[model samples]
Target: MATNVKVIAGDPSQGRTKSSPFEHPYALIPTPSLPTDGSKPHGALLNAVEMFLVHNILIRAINSILYHAPLVKLHDDIKDFLHFCEVFVDFTNLHHDSEEEHIFPEWARACGQPDIMNENVAEHTTFHAGLQELRNYAKQTRDDTTRHSSEEVIRIIDSFAPALTTHLRNEIPTVLQMQQYPNGDEQRKIFAKGVEKGAAQADNTTQIPFALGCHDAGFEGGKHRFPSLPWFVIMGVVWWYGGTHKATWRFCLAICIVGQRRRSFEIVVSEHTRR
Candidate 1:
């Protein structure tokens, strides 16, 4: 409704108008209540990105452990998983701060009139509260290396990753449209401004590394076009451990390579060579 932008959240019929009758979802975890005085903050995408990163890293770490399994050797990888978790949690808290400080305020200003966006900000605030609850529980389990990451914490993270993923997927289209303008010059001006702002703030920083770690490589059955990372990191990850580790390495490699259309030409060449 702001120019050509669409707002899709909340209940859908209380005198629905360009002013907005589309109710926004409770959308976001329970978090600290946000102020409604209309100060444009930051974050939103970063929060979603953090969720994506955590999801990928945690799930991959869990799965990687299974690859080294028979229990005994899993001990070492499990230690790695815990260390990773510590770092992952630290990243998430910082990301959340960006949301509370900057991103939500922007949403509030961007959607001030219908204030659906403002309400969305409120929802984001609640999300922080939920995270705080998680933090308390997590702190209690700090020295513990087991899966004591509360079912609530795990459940929220598990649910949030997919939900946040969906939100980001949906929001990106909106961000593009919001940046577009009446003409090329106008569009470029707006984008230039956005780029300037982004350079200073750069919320996506932690996300890029976390996302790359989670997505680009795997043992078996996943998308392969994600790009190979540095060889040393790959070798260190795949080889330093042992045979079971090698299986996981080969498994990831096989899916990446063999999944490539299963070339009929390879079979043909092999048969010709045999003859």
Candidate 2:
């Protein structure tokens, strides 16, 4: 698991050639976020945040299948799972990106500690890289027109799941703390950004990357596929990522933006119920 990383001591961007320690077994990133005094997270936000990550990577895993399905080399069942990615991952990515860009800054500014922005940005960058690597690997296989086994997909999953999961475990707690926020300002920013982003999310410019459109045509542009298995699994995954898991993503948006609070209602229901 990734330690609670308040600050990273080492430099990655420096040097003639840029590289990450993710490939190395012994690369150590520090967790200055840990206090000298013992304390524990009540996990008010931790559980939901973790589910958000689960949905994200799992859907991307499915999207990898969708992106490669048309090619002769890919397996059919895997391709079937991609529809989940098409509908879920792109939506959530936009949501998370909006959060990072709009929500986090507001929290940092409100809490009067804008310094945490750098760490969150770095973590976001790392997550995108892991995503690109998986997509690239799948794309190369698609081009080969060579048959792929479940084993190959699992290999890709194995490579990505650890890093992505570690990121979820570590980075989540850092942001969810009450100390990092000032009232509900950050939540307000999230809704404003979500409405703005969500409105445009249906456009070709938004979903084309994960699904079919001008940019992805040769690789995966065609009629939309609807598989209930994928959609249902993806809904669960969505709950895992930024879906129904987070009280804030659901309730705060409702509370801060919609001004809906029945008994100071924080999400009336969460993934716990789904489980």
Q: Give the TM-score of candidate 2.
A: 0.43
- Model 1 per-residue lDDT tens digits across residues 1-275: 11111123222222122221111121222222223687532243323333333334434433322222222123233343333343344444454445445544454355442342343334334344444544454455445536453344455455444433344234333333332222334333333344345334533323233333334232122222233356455444333322232212221101112122111010000011222
Q: Name the candidate that leads on lDDT.
A: 2
Task: List lDDT for all candidates, in order.
Answer: 0.33, 0.37
Error of 2 at 201 (Å): 2.6
Off by over 4 Å in 1: 1-83, 86-120, 146-153, 158-163, 183-212, 215-275
